[model samples]
Target: MTEAEYIKEAKKGSSAAQKWLFDELSGRMLMVCRRYVRNEQDAEELMLDGFCKFYSSLSGLQYQGSAALFSWVKRIMINECLMFLRKKHTFVIVSEHVAETLALQEDILDNLSAAEIFNLVIQLPAGYRTVFNLYVIEGMNHGEIAALLGISEGTSKSQLSKAKSLLQKMLLQQNIEYGKRKTQQ
Candidate 1:
């Protein structure tokens, strides 16, 4: 059945259709949750919660296309992760004066796989990770992020700047380590 069919049936309380949708989207949604949350178990739990919310709200969703469906589900998953982070009081925003932005070498990024980049992002602290994900990955502006996270725009910008600086340093260190290993071999 097409996605539209599944969504229509799922909305009508079809358990089989719901199961199919869950199986189709769970992996991607889980990864979305993982971007904001570092803990494996917590990410999984948030993903499940996101799915439950999505299923419950299926009645009101207008199924535009597969892309729209995925985007809506992804947004739900991101919200769940953000709420979890907020409840933990994990956003440690530093002052704007101390914010340092570093230029990341495009060449270095070009050499790394998506998974490698994701791993590097996952290593960032909670505040940096949340702001970075919101601005970079989710394509949200500083103002939107600030409003969503209940922080000032300056704080949002600072977090993103710090995230980038830290990522650049980590990338450089990884390159240096790789060069050393290659020389030894």
Candidate 2:
């Protein structure tokens, strides 16, 4: 069935349509959850929470277009995932000096694939990871990230800049090691 028909059935509370919708969207949504969360179990839980919210809100869905529906649902999923991460990870700002120094660093994310970037991001400390995800991935400005994380804007900017520098260094090191191994072989 087309997406419109499926949405109609889903909004009407058809279990089969809901099951189909969950099965169809779970894989893609899981990838989004995984970007913010490190553990597979936690990602799975976040994905379920997103789907539950999506299904609960289905009655309010008016299909402007297929893309719009997907985008709307994706935002809901991202918010749910962020909320889940917030519960698991706490953010603590260090000092004004540290935050200032962090902002002076340059970003180094130009050449990395999505998976590689996400892997490096997940390795960051909780504060840095959350700031990076909100600022870089979610496309929020530093002020927005600060408000969401309950820190100063300077701290958000600092954390994001630090996250970028660390990611760049890690990627560079990985490249150098890979090149060395290739030469040795």
Best by TM-score: 1
Candidate 1, 40-101: lDDT as tens digits:
99999999999999999999999999999999999999999999999999989799999987
Question: In candidate 2, residue 116 scores what lDDT?
Answer: 78
Off by over 4 Å in 2: 100-110
User: What clash pairs does model 2 have?
Assistant: none
| lDDT (Cα, tens digit) per residue for candidate 2, span 1-185 | 98888889999999998888887788878877777777788888888988999999899888898778777877887788767766765565666567534332244565667777778888887677777888777788988877776788887777777776666677778889999999999
Give lDDT per model, in order: 0.92, 0.77
TM-score per prediction, in order, is: 0.96, 0.86
Estimate the TM-score for candidate 1.
0.96
